[model samples]
Target: MTICRLEVSNPAFTPDNTQFVTVHSSHLNRRHDVSIYNVNAQTENVPIIVLMHGVYGNHWVWMGLGGIHHVYERLRSEHKISEFVLVMPSDGGLRDGSAYLPTKGHGNYEQWIMDDVITAVQKTVENVTINSPLYLSGLSMGGYGALRLGAKYAEQVSGISAHSSITDLLELTEFVDHSLDAYDCRNLHESNIVYWMNKNKNKLPPIRFDCGREDILYSGNIRFVEELKSNGIPHIYETFEGEHSWEYWHTHIVQTFEFFSDIQTHRR
Candidate 1:
């Protein structure tokens, strides 16, 4: 594993440095990079939120284009919700996005996140204990990942929130140009958000997700919510004014952090 630290001198910010660790995945047979935020504080038992990125995005998407650093600063300074570690990891750059799925032979992106990525973070990041609370949020394909993996590994995370999430492989391949030959269509159909939630009904974590009014995935989000209701699963779903753009995600992710914070407080 390769480790590096980025120290930024921003007079207006409290924590000016971000650490990055690249973990070699036996599943993917490659090195995956994870960008960490706010590791300086003594966050012993704080919840760690993993922010997965959309297709065509890398680990830096949250920190760079998503302006998460600005949002983190605002939360700590203004909202006083400090002491959580933010982990941003890539999807192994599988064509478009891996959908965080495990292929038969090539590599297992799902295991890379649920197994390799989390393990690597706990080892490399200081002050992060094995018992630190975990949460997940993502957008687009990343949203699909967080929801599916969060359910599949229900015991690992405390809660999950997704924005503009793709509910199925069909919807995902519609927007991207990559061929999804590696994904099992049968498995994809079975792993649809609603399907997975139904399969893991009793084991689900606290769940919430939102979609923009103009987002192409808006209809899918609505359908998934309906399925949840029909299946007696409780969650928070809302519609906001925006589209499937960075501006939309950047503004609303703050609410996700707050939601996780609430869960953390109540659990204590």
Candidate 2:
């Protein structure tokens, strides 16, 4: 049995309702951090949105750099969205990025997000429970994680959204200096986004992805969307007018929140 332990800390820089948690994951045999924004602690049955970060980013990037907390507040205040607990988790501290795939030597970064992170949130947050609806969203490499993992574990996730995503394992070469061999796993399908989506197409939750027109990854995202259409996989894809930067993610993250809100409304 793998025993995972957690320690909670309040980072001084975090906004009023955010809590930073460090988990000693047996899967990775190292400590990873997760930043949670839980304004709906007193509210029951609030959905949990797990946001993953891309290359060169940590757990706080979503809130500290992207100001997602501010966006959530505005959406909730205006009743444009349902109450949600935001969870931002680090990508297992690999090189420039982990690709969120399980590697032979580096341990299972995939489980670190899918299992340990969710378990920690349930244990720490008062209102988040096993019953809370689970949503996944991310950007760039993180977007790959959200799309792949959400499809692989369709039964556990309610919806998925991504922006400026790396659609294949080879795409990591564009951003990272390391060799792609570091991310190789026995099951090749684990590293391919379209494979998992097609394998679990019947069970996949509502998925949405977008790419900026000028971003380096725009062509790859276009190819991915075309493949999805050819395979009859269900998803939402959009093209925006920005490049791959925090400016783009921060401006368009509202669409992700609103997309999840729409899912929640329809579920009820």
Give the alpha carbon lDDT tens digit for every residue of 1-268 in model 1. Answer: 4222322223255336577767767778877788888766586765688899998999989989999878878887886564688889888877777888877576888878877777776776677778888898899998998898888777788999999999777798767886777765446454566777777889889999999999999998888888889999888998899999999999999878888878877887
Best by TM-score: 2
Clashing pairs in 1: none
Stretches of candidate 1 exceeding 4 Å from the true structure: 1-15, 80-82, 184-190
Instruction: Give TM per candidate.
Output: 0.91, 0.96
Which residue segments of model 2 deviate by more than 4 Å? 1-3, 10-14
- Report how far off residue 4 is in candidate 2 (Å): 2.8
lDDT of each: 0.81, 0.90
Q: How many backbone clashes does every candidate have?
A: 0, 0
**Positional deviation of 166 in candidate 2, in angstroms?**
0.3
Q: What is the lDDT for 88 in model 2?
A: 96
